[model samples]
Target: MACMEEQRAPGHRWPYGPPWRSAPGGAEPGRSGLPWRSTLLLTLFVLVGSRFSAHGQPHRVPLDGSAHALLLLACVPLLWRYRHPVAVPFVTATAALVYLAAGYPYGPVYLAVAVGCLSAVVAGHRRAAWASVGLLWAGHALVALWLYRWLPPAGDKGADLTQEIVIATWVLAVLAVAELARVRREQWARERADRAQAARRRADEERLRIARELHDVLAHSISVINVQAGMGLALLDSDPEQARTALTTIKAASKEALGEVRQVLDTLRAPGAAPRAPAPGLDRLPELVEQAAAAGLTVAVDGEPPRLPPGTDLAAFRIVQEALTNVVRHSGSRHARVHFADGDGMLRLRIDDDGPATGAEAGGSGNGLAGMRERAVALGGTIEAGPRSDGGFRVLAVLPLHTREDE
Candidate 1:
């Protein structure tokens, strides 16, 4: 989770994070090698340790014949431990109790019960695991106490016995540490999955935003060109020269808008693909203004600019594009002015037009203004747009050109 926070922190790479350690090709949790190996190694360890103990101890009866057969039978369920851990441990524990009751050597059975206790701890509820371990240990202790009554005469072997108990405790502690590692690995896997899901959601939202912008930009532009083309056709017989000029301008504007729309659509079609060209930036403002002019919106630019970061450049370009689009659609304006300047550690833009009164009927209830404001604020800037008290609409933005290094 902490890794997720670091990867998504502000000012880091947007939307996508760096690559993660993926699950191996064609490997899945249940079908992977891990569970099989865990079962196989544990089974071998139990069987070998039992045989070795019987051989080492002269007094202990060798677990052969029917008793040995029963012990082997009890362990068949051990292979199911990873998938049905609680069931395996419960069955094994019952078998261990019966084996000890049948008066066989308890050492091998006791060790099996200990391994089962560890599995139960990991796979069962915390309270149930604690209860199971305590009950098994107490049963083993009682069996040991009962055997003490018939054992050979006592010997002075206190230090040796203490050392053996210490070693056994250390072995159990090591096994518990191994279980802890397994749990932490599972936690990391879950965190990685969650991070991937969040990144996908962010990508979907960004795609939606791009789609919305394309719809507004292209739909509105094409609709205007259609209307202008029809008007030119109707006027051709009466006003041949004016109609011819309008038709030419419409062709040029429609072609340019189509190219821009195609570029945006290509991005939407395959986000992972490399772009054919960089997105429009402030350097392309002249081309954008020329297209708007061809659409019959007279536009003038007045001012100089400073070198800017790419992000700022894109934001500036989009702002102008959206503002000019609004003028053509709602302003009924014959002329528009765009002013840009950089000073006092800030870049300022002002767009205004002398046009007719565009009321609520014209669909100019600040949707474009709000979109422009959102764009500016995302890059640490501000915008204000409304009817300019001077009988025109004004869209103005003040953006920071300098900030702290951390920004």
Candidate 2:
């Protein structure tokens, strides 16, 4: 699983892993073999220190074959420190101890130990890093005490104490820097995850809104066309003039449905395209009523429409359109009344039909009603729809004007 995750693009992950780990035969997955940077740094440290010692640096360790081999054991494994953080630090520190115990001059072996400590911490092995630091400090102190007791003094005790303090400070500084890097890496990973999740949620909401728009457009127009076609057939022989009117109504309804559908498809195809026209709002309510009346349902408006925010206006228009369409398609109603009221920052709408109850009116699929409620709720409103005790169906919606404006 770690290998598969590493195979993904670097931008999709935390930026702390070895970059070339995916190269052919580079290293085992999740293991950084010998990175070129680590190799370069270690080689430079050994070569320069060896050259300096050869130039008669009396206190430096001699570059004899055995000492060189020990140095290699301490430093070379650091190339794979990220792969085995704990083991690498222990190996390097152990080799350094052995070299010091052999009475060889203390040279650059401690550089390898410092590198191991840093790698372990940055690799998120906090326990391993602390253990390695503690072991290195203990080993150095014990070795110094042994040398002081057993060997002839080459310098004052004050100088030895200063050297030990300097070395301890350097190790602690390296650990501090590595820990800071790990914290930053974790923060970046969390922020990236949050951004990806937000993007998914936005995509889901856009899809649902588009689905509701398509349903409302298709359902209302299809219901009108169905009613007009029936009326045209009923009057084909008895009244040719009336039949021609019904056919005209069908043609108009089909044309309107096509235009609305085309607009929706065009917007989907070119999301950044300029607006072609304004969306239908409550200003078009009279036209909606006329369409229903033409379809053989008597629809009456009881009050003047109130001013609304664009979002609320569009939602209100759709709710009324859907409710009237339902009456025509399923209520068997001959007369319906649409009442509107504005009071205290709220716009109230009610559609009631005077048709006899049918099975559809009592227990229906209710997709239209569900869509209406969703629209209302999305705009901080509520909708109540059910069969009325007096005989027909009623849909009541209360939308907060101030809430829409605030949003």
Candidate 3:
């Protein structure tokens, strides 16, 4: 804008041109590989229109073989414009300049030069486009104001001020339009890239969500199943009735795990569909205790957990489930306790079990504690798990009472 105002200031050489802005490299090439259709149309328009232009301006030299050749020269390079953005505009501008210096009537030849410049600017070659158009305009100004007397049809006078001003205005308009187009194209490219990145982020989040769900459900249930299987195996020969009881627990655990797995898979099969059953929450604490007892870990619950939003409820349940699963799989203690508290719109749940350091050989597949932390943090909460100085491991989670959706 300041450059444009400078040109309009009195006594500034408006007949020359405006300063050009530096720009980045052009947009990527077109996939169509060739612009044969548009290039051929431009050539045809320039060739057909020159005759009418000559008739309209008799003082200008009429079109002839050399003139026709020069016009084609200007139009032909446009065939490779996208493939060679910088070179194409300069070639077209130089050809047009030579044609005009020979005093060929102004016609669609300028249209060819305009196309070349536009192509260059849109392809991310703004400086080259500006320079090329400026070269053509400067060459025209030189020939019209001075060289007109020495060349072309006899007795052509110096171009008037009005003619030079009109030519300058046209040059300015072309550059302005090209720069505007380049800016717009860059904006669209940025929008497209942003959308793609957002899509990938959403995909990653969904995959992580499914993974956490599967881990919580299977880990807790499988820990129960493993214990029951061991009990059933040992008791199958002695205490047949107790063996039957352990087998029953194993069957129940396996069935629940499969149902939850199917639910997770159903979501993948039909996205945007509601779950076939509501998600588990802290309300399922009694069931978790039953499962833990069946797994040979006695769990004592401390306080009543408040009802929570569906999302918070699910996260809370998964955190507790994972914590208890870690206790069963990683701690040697046969007893664990869950302590829950609510205040100031926050819920804190801590699971602890007495422990001697269980050897690293204790088997578990995924990072159960890490998974717990993820669930807590997703709901604007936090999780901390470490062995206490009292010779016990502890998993603690603090979740917000009001989630963003609830807020």
Highest lDDT against the true fold, candidate: 3
Best by TM-score: 3
State the lDDT of candidate 1 residue by residue for 70-126, as single tens digits.
576557666555556566666776676556544555365655555555655554333
Residue 273 accuracy (lDDT) in model 2: 72
Candidate 2 lDDT tens digits, 1-407: 12112233457654433443222232434554456675578857975685565566555345677777788888888777756777888888888877765556666777788777777776678888778777877777776755544532344132377777887898788788778866765566566566566556666666777778888888898888888888899999999999999999989999998988887777677765754878889999988989999988889899987888888998999999999988888877789999999898889999999767544533234578888999999998999998889888899999977663656
Which residue pairs show backbone clashes in model 3?
26-123, 26-124, 27-123
lDDT (tens digit, per residue) of candidate 3 on 1-407: 11112223367442222222222333223333466777898899999999888898999888899999999999999888777889999999999999999988989899999988987888777899989999998889999888988888788889887898899899999888988877876775675566566667777777888888898888888888887888999999998999999999989999999999999999877767778998888888899999998888899999989989998899888888888888888788999999999999999988899986677554577678778888888888988999999999988889999998986
Clashing pairs in 2: none
Judged by lDDT relative to the true structure, which candidate is superior, 2 or 3? 3
Candidate 1 colliding pairs: none
Q: Estimate each model's TM-score.
A: 0.75, 0.78, 0.89
Off by over 4 Å in 2: 1-57, 64-86, 95-119, 147-169, 237-240, 360-365, 403-407
Alpha-carbon runs more than 4 Å astray in model 1: 1-41, 97-124, 146-175, 216-220, 223-227, 268-273, 354-356, 360-371, 400-407
Relative to the true structure, how large is the alpha-carbon lDDT of every model?
A: 0.63, 0.76, 0.83
